[model samples]
Target: MSGLRPASAGRGESGRYEAFDHLATMVAVLRAADGCCLFVNAAFEAALGLPRRALLRRGRLFDWFVDASALVTNYQAVVANQYSTVRLEALLRRPTAPHAEPLPVHVIVTQVDHGETILLELVEIEQQARQDRETRTLDQVRVTKELIRNLAHEIKNPLGGIRGAAQLLEMDLADATLTEYTQVIIHEADRLQALVDRLLAPHRRPHMVADVNIHEVLERVRSLVLAEFSRGLTIVRDYDASLPEFRGDREQLIQAVLNITHNAALALAERRQAGDARIVLRTRAARQVTIGRQRYRLALELHIEDNGPGVPPEIRDRIFFPLVSGREGGSGLGLTLAQDFIQQHQGLIECESEPGRTLFKIQIPLP
Candidate 1:
């Protein structure tokens, strides 16, 4: 919890936790002496689904909480300069969803600046559980990445020796038929070496960053996909032209899109062998989008959607895992690498699949 910085009373964080928009905890700063609201962070606004304009207009800072009397008492305690901190679980209402149930939150109130101002923190009960699940998933991914890197290195160590031995054996064999067996061994070794290299690739290379035009990347992928699947598939474009450029690795983004598009094309081909296969490349600006716990004001959404047989039920949950493949002879590293690249940009990839329809949605925050 060393990374946890206390939000200041007067105006949340005193420049410390001010930029901690990623925390799911809703926080606000208030004028302690008068019980007036001061500043509210992104998480708070997103949690309640209310704009700052509406929140501040609702009345006192603590008015959003259900037990107004409890908040009043808490504020009194702060103003009196008796206790430095207070905590309680409270039901918090949202102006946007008035008819719905109030959000259950664990609230914290603290006096700072010699009781001149108060800091309030609200952590949603359900969001905490969601965060825990996300943390567990991330930890599993970390462990898997390490495992892939280590295993790839282990396989690589003896790989060169095996391939070299096979080559030498091939040269020694006078019988062409027997030499063909040695050639098979060499070919397989080379294939394994290539796979191992791909497994180790992300760790070996440093990310290249530049201002990326998403449409340009999409266009490149579109052209490549069309060239490959010229006759069978129909690729449709649905783009929001107003989106702005953001910094990222252009090559990485291209690869991510390519891998997803390529997979969609394959799936489409399998489901509809007689043509009428359709794949859609969609781009849109997502406003006030929350990825995991963090809320971004603006984000880019790139969707590669296809009409195909849905993901196989058994492997659906493990689709992004390294070496898990739906298609026969599929490397299975495409989605894994695609996921890794997007995560490098503080982005996420989500999938939705059903009979005759499969969609892969990639989201990255736009600065």
Candidate 2:
């Protein structure tokens, strides 16, 4: 009877452990003193790529982070404040590939067991961030394109009439001094005509969809920028060789990519002692991207990054709108047109900026 009793207790313990191990969501238990993880479910192990054995002996929960000391201090404060839950970003280094880029994580930390232990749950951030960016870019493109189309139409008829009236006055007027006023009217009309033409150009052109190779488009833009700014700037290519050809208008795509690269080059040109003024053209393949609430099988991601003084905060939010420029004497229609072209091809363009590093990402469907 005593031997049977011991066997029954052992089986019960094993059954309970197995039940928690097979849970759908990730869960972990840690020691309160130093935050060493004592138990981790299978889901937790798969998400973090950390085994139970390794985490069980950890000195602190933040020890596995690339920036461990800072993370620990920040987290300790959050817990000490008696906060029930806290959320923040954490960069965790992989055990095998410590030197590689740290994994970006959205962490949720909560106090458990009467503030004795802390529970940390992490979700990858890149995918969510990309989606948010795409949504914003698409919205901007749609709104800007509509505005450009409407404004161009509204200005075209009036501009033509003004120019015609100026010509008539110049022909009939006798006073030489009055001729200058008519000439001014004619010149202003011509300037507005030019702006209107640029605004209408994207919509007026017919799209020629072809099996376009994105790298080729990027390479062409790189060569053109290098030819003009070759004196003090360098363009770097970091393309993913395996990226497949996407169906898009070749000429329009080239124009779109060129506009972004050209803007970056111009920004770099205005800096003093801009060490290694560089624009990096990079490509990657993305999966499960949602556009307009519809999920895509594959998407082509092209990034144009620069190390220039970042975009001005004043006009950053309205950068895609026509006539909004950060530089003095700059026509801001370049990005507006670029956005229009990419949107026509069912793609999105987004920008992230900070001092010394700015990234513009273009994503298009791969089919």
Candidate 3:
């Protein structure tokens, strides 16, 4: 926190720094002159359960809240250089949620060092602490994705040369004895190439958009999984018949669900031997769900639950990382790819695991 400056305060209007992106307190920087939001932290997103893009569309801070006349009054006063701070209580309305109640909050409006930039802080009287922590983890996930994308590119570049060298060596080897060595080299190289391919698959593939039926995707994965472990596992379906269609890439979604289900099946290996392995594919619709910053009126919730020896706590925090797998001989790219695909659709994926039960939840908004 040392030697860091506020984006709205010290810098000129040309470019603002995002100094508060990781904060636990809900804070949004708005242009006091026009009352337009310039920046918002993760806590703000959690507190309001609204997307930044949606907020930007609204064009004003007070427009999305209930009884926000005080906010407007404070904004005008701050922009006019009449007040440095203002505090009040207000009811925050969540219009997207069906039959939602007004959220009670303590609102504080303060002027930054820069003129006309008011920082609106909201303290949700009910669930401030929990919401702050969860949303802050989400913010870290976003940052982690950027780092993963850059690092994956770096790791993939040399794979081609290594594979090619192994191929050329195999071709040039004349003696059968030496050919076996080259064959081993070629085999290992190809394996690495395949692994690298999975790592790069999400970023390399083009996003194809179409009206996606999530049930169809699930059914496909279920069939494939059943066919592979035909006798050992029980895959159950618990889908909502009323789920509407949403726009997404069908193939990508299929692959994402498949990876998750397949991972569950593998984890249930010991349980399968016990003759009681079960994996349930449950689907429901959440009326008001927020993912990354977007609040959806309705989002499909897909739960892939398995009764296996749960994910080890040591690797739970890093399960989605590019190469962090729990099972032996696992590539560890499954969850990473699933996460990438979900994020592409303005969605989110979360997991909860304990002994004898592991649930992987996928939430994708219906457009």
TM-score: which candidate is best?
1
Q: Write the per-residue lDDT of candidate 3 for residues 174-291, one digit (tens) a residue.
A: 8767878777776886787677667667878899999988889999999999999886799999999899898899999998899999999989998888878999999998754556
Q: Model 2, residue 144: displacement in angstroms?
A: 3.0
lDDT of each: 0.82, 0.76, 0.78
Task: Name every residue pair that clashes in candidate 3.
Answer: 51-293
Backbone clashes counted, model 3? 1
Please report how far candidate 2 places residue 306 from its true position, in Å: 1.0
By lDDT: ranked, best first: 1, 3, 2
* Candidate 2 lDDT by residue in tens digits, 36-80: 665666655655677766655664556677776755665576568
How many clashing pairs in candidate 1?
A: 1
Worst 10 residues of 2 by lDDT: 1-10
Ranking by TM-score: 1, 2, 3
TM-score, candidate 2, is 0.68
Q: How far off is model 2, as Cα RMSD? A: 9.2
Off by over 4 Å in 1: 1-24, 29-39, 46-50, 60-94, 97-106, 111-118, 124-134, 174-176, 203-208, 226-240, 268-317, 343-367
Candidate 3 ranges beyond 4 A from true positions: 1-157, 163-176
